[model samples]
Target: MDIESQNSPQFFSWDSLPEQLKSILPLRHSYLIKNFNVLSPFQTTENFEIPQFELDAFVDIDDKEKAREWFLSFESKSKTTMPESRRYEIKGKKVLFREKRHCIHSKLVKEKQGNRELKRPQSSRLRNTNCAATIHLRLELCNIELSHPLEVNLRFTHNHVVNSAESLSFRRVNGEIRGKFLELFKDGHSPASAMYDYEDALYLSATDEQELLVLLADRATDPDYDYIAKLFHKYREMALGDRNGTSMFKRLEEVVNDYNNSGHGKAILQEYDSRTGKAFILCVVTNLMNRVHERVLQSGELCYMDASASFEPLNTSITLLYTSCMVGALPLGLFITSDESEITLEKA
Candidate 1:
């Protein structure tokens, strides 16, 4: 942590730096002009549809909840701060909730400045697929905000067949898979690594090959790394807080945000260097771990503990408190310490 080591230029490869990489995807104006016709949002006085899909017509329904159910059916997620399946617009007495589902393989939206495309040196997350497959819901509010007739627009004419292999991108991830992925990611694993580890973990946890296949049946046709990688980054920012923060205490603070409390929850034990106020001996035990350890103790099972030094490149020692299970050793507590001293060992 010295100034000389920090300022060293030999720490990384030249090609791996942010400046060396191609930052932005250049607008494919030629392909856009040739393959598609529509670009800007323009409507005529005759065609007064909400989403303005050319071939689709709006359906009328009386119930507002049914309109919401229609929105959720598409698995349409929110691109804005609004929750999924909850986008709406209010005009006078008319209360409108629109659900627009775009084709996954649809053409990319352009970033235009005036008439020309706005080409930037940096990367952008702004997306407009220009896909026609969509739905729009419109409803009117009577006096005292009473229920009125609802209008549902249909443009489910996706460019690709729904059951086709290319359309697999449209499949929604179930809560189980999403929760597991988030858990692994929050435990300091990369997207690719976490995926691989998850598969291995599943395989190891299952009783046999048959059981493994049964567990992985739903995930057999799951979207690959390319699609999940984008979701991973988004989940990291929203679920897990800023991963690039310089403060170690801030990270510990984030960890203890929910997982740890004075009352029976995840516990964090630490030994800090008085000079720098930096935690050198850090041990974390989750609620699950506490429950497992308690079970082991209650069952009068022989528990095992071990300390391994310098297994990682972080110049720290790892202390593991585990018990043998049917499949493998179940880790009850994990500790990362600067040294394998008596104080650190006691804390672990």
Candidate 2:
């Protein structure tokens, strides 16, 4: 019998799969498998169990190559010539770079008296194997249809649809993002002290645009909970130095700058600095307030009050704080002092 002919798709079925996969075939093949399992033994398996071989119920193609070939044969969908490899067939597949190299070998050691003895072991052969063992299967394309028609081709600055959709799908859970960064600047915590963990968290979470936005939004706001805000104020006040010396604004600027220069925060820093950003920071704070309140309500902590009423105070506070910074700073030409203008401490 010819080897090529022996390997043909015909005369091959689930029965022909490897033993490991063949064990799973009965469960897959039984039409009543779902209902059968529902009549529970009241037990759950910890590991996933897949049949050794399964017929391609959705697609007619058996082999990955055949699937690739079918996609390649399609007429040029565009004016441009299509490449030999088609995207749909190859999108998530990984081709082996080279044959496996033997790096580590397990050895059995037997100790007799003071000396040790090494032994080679024998292995059992697999029997009644099925096609599932030999053939690696792929996930069927998800046949998802949008409930609402997407007008993706529209010309708009920043493309609202794309941005909105991405924001919905990819936005980080607000509490998680806040808790992570707060872990760094935590009471008495500085980047210098927590540099190792800070670098790791920054690299891991901040790389994605949505995550970057989340962290930036988190740091760019004052704490929301009344208690937390009071605590933050207390800490800041305690850290503040005596009159004529230390400024919290300068210190905050340095800390925020440090956060921005590291990993993903750099992009956020650039975007915020390039644009009129106070409003964006306000919006982020609003997002946090709404998100946290929703979570609290879900957990039965607080009844959902009017979000608008809750947000107004924060908005006012943010504006007042920003205004204080702006109002206090003296322009170069407005005031000049070379230890010339001085105010004496009034002993009250």
Candidate 3:
């Protein structure tokens, strides 16, 4: 390896030449020697010239890690010495796509006898009409903290019923957060205690970039974080408490079943990468129940609790979601409902 070749101008990006040269100097001389000069002593000029001999000295440094380290070291020094504007380029976030829809609640009223106006309660009407929803989610990576950890925040709003056809209505829900850190750790086989740093935890546990974003969204904005975290703790403790307990067995089966049915638990467990590495997932599937019912008997105090709870708490243990651009199964990207949003990361 010729030292001269390592300094070539041809191989340097416009910004790299100065930084690269800084790395070659002895640490003590580069930092401590205030008045020392490599060329002429006691001569100072604000402007610096690129040396012809060093122009062709740039060599291929194939190790990206080493290059990054050198670049960062130079950057740190520049931050202190250079003016603020020239220190670094701040990457601006560009909106990828935005879909907006208006939601208006409609009363489910049977044709009244004659042309008299019929009255109905909004709450009861809300429960009676079978709502089919297509939630639009706005996603933006507003800020990214390099090295230490990535912080993501999601701000959302909603419109009521967009379209209602027959028994189904299409609309978006804007205020629910569906994922948690515990899920990320458990599904990725990482201990919850290992999550001291959010960014590193993400890099270690999330295989796909989308999943990473989803996980961050879950951590930062999901309102149900505490509830989910509690559930995870209880679930984990129960499993460890009795390996063959009846409750454990039932829970495991439910997790597995949920995964097969594209349920919330399973959605959180799937991951994919579009271009880089194979991804693992920790999906936060929400709005687990959607019902379509006929108006049967009229009652003032009917207990409308989950009629389908019997088939609930699905098995989501071995579930995974794959990303496909063409005609494929499974919902892609982010989907929001009138009450909640589900963020899933697929590694491509």
Candidate 4:
């Protein structure tokens, strides 16, 4: 027979197929045949218990995007992916896809003595098996209308025995667990704290640490700090908004320069050295500080000036001029200097 004719479904029976071809059949098919007399014509009349192969019931989603999101969520839990060789097929409004994954086993066996051998063979690694398990997702239109919601069906098929403890799907956070995490996050708990609470609620051993944190961070309203930092470098204009389209430090410099040039009746003082002609002390009273001066004049006679190390860990001091206001003591002006010397303070 020609290659195509030999491979045709009608051309060969299961018993007549070559051992290599039969071995390549899906793992679940073997399990089905072993558990049920599905291939035997006479046993078709007999009633047999069929094993359940569904992990979750069909879910109805609003749109294709929502269906994809649901499938992704399921895939995340299962840690599996659709085979690259097979493309997802769409028929009418229905989409069908399958995910397959491999299984690995490790074991240690005692060494066996061999005849006339100097030493027995030590324990060796065993071959890994591509456990031909599969998860099928079918998304179909719920109604005759094309715009109707999609109904998603999830089915699991496995040929090998499953150890529930080792399964990713079993360890993954379910809807209930995710809902609790969201509630905690909305209540102002940090991702780390929320993950801790989730573990505590489930009495889980603290072995898996990062999964919950990653999931919560992905769903959080605030952009992750690392992502924001990356965006600040890559998309500086968007990250800074309307702040002169400059980086954070450059924007601070621009504010200082603008205040110095505006001339708002408040002093913009700078003292240069007589020898080097280099600026030694520079301080500016901004337009906002000028308004604060007016408020200080109206509020009280007593004013306070204090000098201390700057909040940031630097060799600089911040001098603050405060006045009593109706809302309590408020700073009228701020001066930052390289040193707390009397000469620098006088210039400020």
On TM-score, the candidate that comes out on top is 1
The collision pairs in model 1 are none
Which candidate achieves the best lDDT against the true structure? Answer: 1
Report the C-alpha lDDT of model 4 over 1-348, residue by residue, as the tens digit.
112222211223445543432333222111111111112111112343222232222233445565556555544433433332234555654433332222222111111122434332572422222333444444554442433233322233333223222322222334554455557655545555655565565445334556444444332212333433343334434433443223543545555676567786344434333365433344656676677777567535776888888574335677788787687877677777667777667766
TM-score preference between candidates 1 and 3, better one: 1
lDDT of each: 0.48, 0.27, 0.30, 0.42
lDDT of 3 by residue, 247-293 (tens): 55466456757675864433333322335543334433333221111
Q: List the residue pairs that clash in candidate 4.
A: none
Clash totals in order: 0, 11, 40, 0
Cα error, residue 138 of model 3, in Å, equals: 25
Candidate 4: how large is its RMSD?
A: 16.0
Ranking by lDDT: 1, 4, 3, 2
Stretches of candidate 4 off by over 4 Å are 1-63, 72-245, 249-305, 313-317, 322-332, 336-348
**TM-score on alpha carbons, each prediction:** 0.40, 0.15, 0.16, 0.30
Candidate 1 displacement at residue 279 in angstroms: 4.7
Report how far off residue 291 is in candidate 3 (Å).
Answer: 67
Identify the runs in model 2 with alpha carbons over 4 angstroms from their true place.
1-173, 190-199, 204-348
Ranking by TM-score: 1, 4, 3, 2
The better-scoring model by TM-score among 2 and 3 is 3
